[model samples]
Target: MAAQVLALLRALSGPEAPLEELRALHSALQAVPLGELRERADDLRLGPLFALLGPGSRREQTTLCVSILERLLQAVEPVDVARNFRVDLQKGLAHPSDSVKTLTLSQVGRIVESSDAVTEILNNAELLKQIVYCIGGENLSVAKAAIKSLSRVSLTQTGLEALFESDLLDDLKNVMKTNDIVRYRVYELIVEISSTSPESLNYCTTSGLITELLRELTGEDVLVRATCIEMVTSLAQSHHGRQYLAQEGVIDQISNIIVGAESDPFSSFYLPGFVKFFGNLAVMDSPQQICERYPVFVEKVFEMTESQDPTMVGVAVDTIGILGSTVEGKQVLHKAGTHFEHLLMKVGYQVKNASTELKIRCLDAISSLLYLSPEQETDDLLRMTESWFSSLSRDSLELLRGISNQPFPELRCAALKVFTAMANQPWAQKLMFNSPGFVEYVMDRSVERDKTSKDAKYELVKALANSKTIAEIFGNPNYLRLRAYLSEGPYYVKPVSVTAVEGAE
Candidate 1:
């Protein structure tokens, strides 16, 4: 079956083959045996079949050819098959036909994903250099595919080292500066490269690529801005990258974005990423120095807490949280009480309907604010809670009920976290326990014995820990058994049990 399928595929891929025959050939090849397919991959006719199929006008045929090449690569040894068709494949990289180049690049990506093939290719430095050169070629599509292939290959440290030593970075920068269409691709490549060998950024920085990327962040293209923001954020994550970003005036640009009050949606989306970037920077650098140098930026972030857009509020909340988590941030928020109160109010409002991600962020912000603010600000905190606590509690209870009935453990865990946080608040606790049958309802659901229900029980343990009221409510022998199961079941289960025990005490 495989021999016949390969023969048909080879014949259909020839120039003289009718399109109908090729379509039929593709249909027949789908059921071929793996071993037989491997044997056919070495057939001399396979090269022309792949080359012809690579550039076919029909998208289906082209996709099938690419799939065939990928399957063949998996089935056959790369060393045995690659040498025979290397020249033909390289030619497809520059083929005037788009279909051919696309399929060929797809094949290259697959080969790059294979560790042994990548190692073999890298050992042939000349061939590797040629491939790198193709990454910056004039054809945007081809260049993008080549860049993606390189990124996949560079997953290994040796391959990453090769990329750092090669001229790929220089070429990418040159394209970034000169080419608008490919700028996004260049930005992606920068991120991929940085992720693999963030230290390689030093080489780029020495060559002034960091400055170029910073400039690109201000580009009019939203995609370019977004990509540059992501890349900068990734770069700023590392100690060396943070130093480079700070030196490149990235913080100033980021500060301007937050304080500039730019109402552009694109800018708004990029702002949180930038804030996150700065958070990483703060983690790496001295937050005290950063705060002192950019006090106004911090102020503006606090001011943005009152923004109508939940997104802005979320970012501001997060930025403040990052700041407040540090001594410098705590000091700044302490001096900015009215600002913190307004921010907390916005966060409370956001918790009502914010996306899950933003809600998680708001939760983190609340935790941070609770930690940093003076005890005297309890009134402000309580006021913030009053505004949205009822709605959030209602929503959280519904989620808890839903998770209790669901089989997934993670959702139940998430519900428990929301409950525990609410259970921590005095007013929320009073409301929850006072609600009609709410206490017994939760306790009943908590005792269900499904594997997925462990999360519910674990959360019950936490809720019981948060308040003396809960400890008294569930202090029975049954609840105690649940607590022991949570503590001793597995290493992973013990933390929740400990929290419950501490809360109960």
Candidate 2:
């Protein structure tokens, strides 16, 4: 069996190894006992597996190598695997094939996930160097994987020390020196590591990479600033990260950038990120406070809503949806009064006139704005969303109802989701009850054929049935019908009686 395994490895390493041979190798390796495989791990010469994953390898071959490698690596201690395959893995990282580098990074990622593997890779300066070098590779996938692996490594204290404090930090700096594209890739890795924990963030801060990245946020390079905006947004996802940004006045720096963005001709390049960063910041923290501190963010959002560019409109609409979803956020927009009113009208107009993709986004934004979870549904917020919904158009329900009847399934489902979001609201419920055939539409499962549409219809029915205000607004008969629809479930089909079927056959 060992000889057979060795033979198969040799065959697989061949330039033209047949697919059958690959399959056979996979099956034979699976049949090998774990203990035996471990004992023979060295003799197995797994180096060829990495070669088989090189460029032009068939999908099945690549997948087979990954599976086999995962099983083998899991059976043995990661330290031994690293010790034995260190040179091969390093070569794979430097291999001309992006396939080779990605596959190698995948293994390194696996190794780092285990506590025992960290030290060996950390101690191997050459191995660490190779991994860091991959971050600056031309291949985006390879660079992302390399960043992912290194980020996993930095999850530990020792890994953090090795990356930020040791000579390997110099390697990372060298990698960043390659170009702006490569430089941002390294910055991305630093942000990722920093996002993990306070201590990890401290390490990153001490290394001065975070400061450097923020400097570029206000830097002259439009492209680099655009890239940095995205990275900083990611950093802001964490509590500590957001606090760090605010305390460091990076939030103000980003706000200043957004204000200045309109004057920059290349503003189009980075404007979306700038808007999205504020959108994210608003929801993550206090919508009112962030908007107040950076009124330009809100001004830009509204300006974007009115832009002719679909991209700008989409981001603005999305930000509005996000801000409107929360109670505090809803109040902030509600206080804007007519500006908010005008924005809702704009979204409705988009739903009617925009492209299918934009229509879906409009519907999503509407859903987010109107939706209030059972816990969060206070009288004021409900009235606020209702007021916003009413302000959408004199016949807001009719607009979405017409959209619900569209041929496009995605558009139709998105419209139904908007209904689901507003189903519990007293005003929305009354409007539905008053609208002809609206209750029937909600009850008719037959209208929705596809699984997505079916699930969406079920959700709407469920929302209506569960609403505390629904029964009172809809009255008992219609309410009972909603409950019946809910009882039947999402995919229920009505049974047809066929007494004479056997005779007819």
Candidate 3:
């Protein structure tokens, strides 16, 4: 059996093996038990299989070879594959086909996930170099896969040392110096590895790579800073990353940059990221603390809401939504008092007059502002959300109902989302009952035509039916009507009854 498998693989070693032959080999290998294959691994001569994965191979051959290689790897010891197969795997990475490189990197990702395989992988310096080099390649998909594999390798202490404590660290630096795009890719990889744990983050910090990335955040190049801000935001997603930034005073530095951005001609380019970073910070940490600590961040968010630039307004609106999602965030925004009211007015105007995209964003922000989880349903927060809803206009419910009737499905769904968020509030439910057709609209199955719109309307009815306050607000009869709607799922169409009218052709 070993000799037979070896001869079949040797047949495929050439530039373009016969497609039918490759398929036959793949099927034959599938039937062989992994234990039997492992016993005969030496005679299997897998190098030829890896060769079929390289450039100049037909697509069908490449696909079949990948399948065969996967099965074969499970048979061969992972450590041996990591050690002896290094050169062939590097050839796959160097292959001209992005598909080949991606498929190869995926296998590498699998190998590194096993503890026994990582040391041998880390031992091969050239393989490591090839992976890092791929990060700067032309294909974004290939670059991302390379990034993922390298990040996985750095998950352990030994792997971190190999990447950061060795000459490969210098190689990474040189790659970054090649271009801003390559530099950001490296930055993204570092952020991914560092976010894993305090130990991994410590290695990244000690290497000075994290500091170098922060330096770019304050660099003279607005484009680089803009790109770097996103990476920094990614890093900030992890608690350890956020702690490192705070300890290094990076948050203060970002706020100062926002303050000075008004004078820069390129302010618009980077300011949104700067704002979003703070928005993320506010949610991750304490919203009130962040807003108070950096009043400039909040001020900038509100200012951008009024900007003529759609991008700026969109980010600002999103930030507002984030800040208002939590109880603390709501209090912080409510502390602004009249300023908060003005922002709501702008959002209402946008809902009525802005582009469909912006209008949906405005509705989302309103939904975020009005939402009250059952646990957080304190009297003060409830009143606060009610007041915010009222400030939208004299008749906020009527305005949203108008949006729900719009022909655009997205706007209709967004408008319904806002109602869903409002559904649990007793005050809002009272208003819904008082409004002439609003209750009927919520119950009307024919109102929403598409799946998404139907789902949105069902969610609204479900919220109303499930609310503890529903029976009290709308009498048991109306509440029972909502219950019936809830019993029928989103797509439950009522069966139509047809009776032939007495042969009246």
For all candidates in order, the CA lDDT equals 0.60, 0.85, 0.87
For candidate 3, the TM-score is 0.90
Where does model 3 exceed 4 Å of error?
A: 1-16, 23-45, 53-84, 498-505
Listed per model in order, the count of residue pairs whose N, CA or C atoms clash below 3 Å is 2, 0, 0
Instruction: Tell me the tens digit of each residue's lDDT in model 3 across 43-92.
Output: 66776677667566677878888778877777777677777788888898
- Model 3 clash pairs are none
Clash count (model 2, backbone only): 0
Top candidate on lDDT is: 3
RMSD to the true structure for each prediction, in A, is: 9.4, 3.6, 3.4
Q: Please, what are the lDDT tens digits per residue for candidate 2 over residues 1-505? A: 6567777877764656677887888788777778877777666667677667666777777777767676666556667767778887887787776766776787787788778777778888788888899888889999999898899888888889889888999999999999988998899899999999999999999998898998888889888878889999999999999999989998888788888876788898889998999999999889999888889999999899899999999999999988987888888888888998998899889999999999999999999999988888788887888888887777989999999998779998999999999888787888899999998888887788799999988999999999998888999998899888889888888899867656674
Give the per-residue lDDT of model 1 (tens digit) for 26-109.
666677767777666556256655645534345665665565555565566655444566776666665655556666666666
Give the clashing residue pairs of candidate 2, or none. none
TM-score of 2: 0.89
Q: What order do candidates take by lDDT, descending?
A: 3, 2, 1
